[model samples]
Target: MNNFLAHTFTKKAFEQLASIRNQYSVSIYLPMYKKGKELNEGLGQSNLKSCLKKVHAVLVEYGYDKSSVNDYLKPIRNLIFELSFWRNPSEGLAIFLDKDKGMRCYKLPFPFEIKTYVADHFYLFPLLPLFHNNGIYYLLELSRDYVKLYKGSRNNFRDIPIKKIIPKQLEEVVGFDFEQKMLQYRTGHMMYPAGSFHGQGEGKEDEKKELLSFFRKINRGVTKMISDKKAPLILACTDELYPVYKKINSYHKLWDTNLSGDPEFKGTNELHKASWSLIQYYFETKKREKLAKFISKFHTSLTTCQLSEIIPAAVKGKIDTLFVQQKEDVFGTYNSAKGCLILDSYKEMRNISLLNMAAINTFLQGGNVYFLEAEEMPVKNIPMNALLRF
Candidate 1:
């Protein structure tokens, strides 16, 4: 079985792409459908054909022999028949090919709009969403009969195999003996009912203490499993249980906002949608704080919105953080040797996006990029903005 959960867009993958110095590098981004006829085999083949047609045009324009180009793309063509690969679809797929690099493919956790970029170096900005999406978060659903754990991102959610480490039910951990013990406590120590279907010999306070003890045990196991992964954990349970869980939670990165109500009735899609809405605000607020600092230090020779100056600085590893409009594109070329930018009319360089180059270069140099709405940007007139390291 494939452990897709281990897949990550690592720094080594970025270095490999940045080092490719090929004459005809092809970058293809395809939106993948999870199911139906679109996912079976036909859609992947059709998309590859469409992308190849575009690549063929670029090769012809650059004066490459048709046979040589075909040979370079042959491995990619054969990948279309890998039924097992096609069956396990994520949100998107990216394919990079060249004469020297051969062909490499990545199944992304987030979807990309279908597009093709044929360039001298591999076009990499389309893969940024995998990094910028803040990766994954854990969701713990609590209840008497249905305690479940899930591994989730903004676009996908799946159950985590945690039954072995953490017990999934009250009976599994405390056993049926607690029921008779609770009745004894209630008859001897309490003057009123404990307010739920399940009861024993204890008062409400004692019962609550027992439940807290159970939750703390679960939390310790969960923390041990996810401590190395620093992703946020969100708790989903009833309103009454939320406070109890929060009080006992030892995980440092547990999200303040939680999924309230019983999660047993909720579908994966519904839970993911709600969780994403809350998590997005956390990401945006973090970006805003960084952007605000950039604005404050603009006069210290460490911040800029000038495309001409920022492009070369990004190439030299000076950028610390960047904020750019999500879908905006600018047509131009950069001369890395002399740190010069050559802007062209839209009719001249239709395929090259200078904005994408800036973002890609920044990421390659270990800088951060935030895709903000127009209103959220520090400057609305310029397409790019950055905070410099030096």
Candidate 2:
């Protein structure tokens, strides 16, 4: 079971799946429920069974003999009744199969539209959010008494243990003898405990200095914990603490915007919601900036919205960025020898998805790929667009 199924989906896995080209590649996507009656009642397993049925039908329609089709789908069929496999499901399940690669399944974090595709290549546009820039980040819940670290993506968040590497509380680093009065309040509105002396201007400055020292230690620990230094780190703290932390933060990718408010009062889900909102804006801004660049170069040789031009450019590693319309498929075959693209209204035996090919090539060659709504495309009504490297 562990050999066939994967819980974590990475860009490397996506690239491997995309690189496969076969005569009877099978891609299946099923929306899964993590909780509720649907989970307990085996609805996910049932849904998978239905999807497998579709896959079997599609294989038959392609003229594979009954025995060959059954043998090809046997791996998936074994999973239909595997109760344990369905019990711990993610928001979606993606399965890819071919004669050469056997079968690989991923329980992905994002919900997917239920569909299946049997073609020369796997359908992968549904997994783009995980690969998008700003899609993954770290959220540091910073406070004097409590500290936590979370690794977050566009739709998932999980705690990353920092207790061993970092001090869990400011007292651990600054010692218990530091001014108790200063520690009582983080914001201007925070009330001093009854009978505690409320200090004047100098005390506030001292508090800042103490916090700066504590944050410096935290910054060191956080830097050590983060394997990807370029990934953004969002600070979750009150407005007052943000400036003090900023003064001490050594991380280059700390987000300019802090997750404002007292993080102590927020649950993990609340923190995820707030942080994802900020990251989404960051992602949108980047996409818009790219779109603006595309528009500026619209009439030049550096940019193009034509599928014929984009497909070959991608194959040759000439695209800097490729924009594809969401929920749309352009099936075709590309002749590398002739530098030609032939579009088909329907999927055929020899044709693959041109948009998928362009995206995969661009991504594999270190270019960016963005899936946008029809209205958000650089050129309206164009299904695909590209910014060329040369």
Candidate 3:
């Protein structure tokens, strides 16, 4: 009741809408928030009857027919009918069709509100623990990319993500904020805790299932949207979970790497040292060509923390990728963070400047980190290892 279902259309529709935008020689100026927009009666030709009919056909074809759509679409439908009256395209009437859906019309002039699903194609998922503090008092590490992050004040929700990116690759590349359909990771959603190492407590099947199902559904839906549309996949999890998460998705869980519950790793101090060595190995062997090829090259793999640390080393700047049961903070140059680089640091590394390389930075760098799975964080678990090639 709080939010509407049709609101979901905002995300997909905006993406589809853009495909047809250039046809009108018009540029869309989306808002960062709900600033009250001006509703243009028609975004198509006056003689839009033919267009409406075609759109209707598409709606019927797509699954929105009778089963999915509602009984009332008065305003939206009439807006389509009004299109047929326009004569020229200059009146800004054309390029109005986006995927030909059952709901052809919408609450027009949707001011560019950045929160939730208000932006043309922007969506936000709140913060999740990815890594934790390394000291006695454990605190989670938080990181985000392609998002508008606004830090809340005292007593306010800290690390709350207000916007999530679900736009087309083209829009994302050009820096377009399209807040459309918004989703959240709810409680009992299958997550491995902030820094969980055990899968389900001794008697937590029901609890685990509830959480797992949620994560699975989201993962399935999200991966598809991201893969097909080449959209950005924003993840917020625990630092310990990241390595295990990566291993499950890709990477060989080699016993030789000594990630098992070994007796030697009975404490945090030992585990952090081991994990640090593993990371050091990767950084030491990193290659410039492999990373440089994608530096600002415009590609999809750029979003995941999978390639998180590579670029940080490339710039030879300070980068804190996260180590041990608790999250550790590292300070370094901010240049690459502007784009084609890594995370931001508190202490500017002696060899680097935290200067903005541009204005945008990559989402995977570890300084501002989070967890993905718990096993990767063992008392002596060195779960993740960065890969480097000659």
By TM-score, the best candidate is: 2
Tell me, by lDDT, which candidate is best. Answer: 2
The C-alpha TM-scores of every prediction are: 0.80, 0.85, 0.18
**Candidate 1 Cα deviation (angstroms), residue 36:** 8.1
Ranking by TM-score: 2, 1, 3
Candidate 2 structure quality by residue, lDDT tens digits, 286-348: 778888999999899999988878888998999998988888788888899988778889876
Candidates' C-alpha lDDT: 0.75, 0.82, 0.28
**Model 3 clashes, total count:** 59
Sort the candidates on lDDT, descending order: 2, 1, 3
| TM-score for predicted model 2 compared with the true structure | 0.85
Better of 1 and 2 by lDDT: 2
Q: Model 1 shows how many backbone clashes?
A: 10
lDDT score for candidate 3 against the true structure? 0.28
The lDDT, on a scale of 0 to 1, for candidate 1 is 0.75
Task: Give candidate 2 regions above 4 Å deviation.
Answer: 1-3, 35-43, 176-198, 201-212
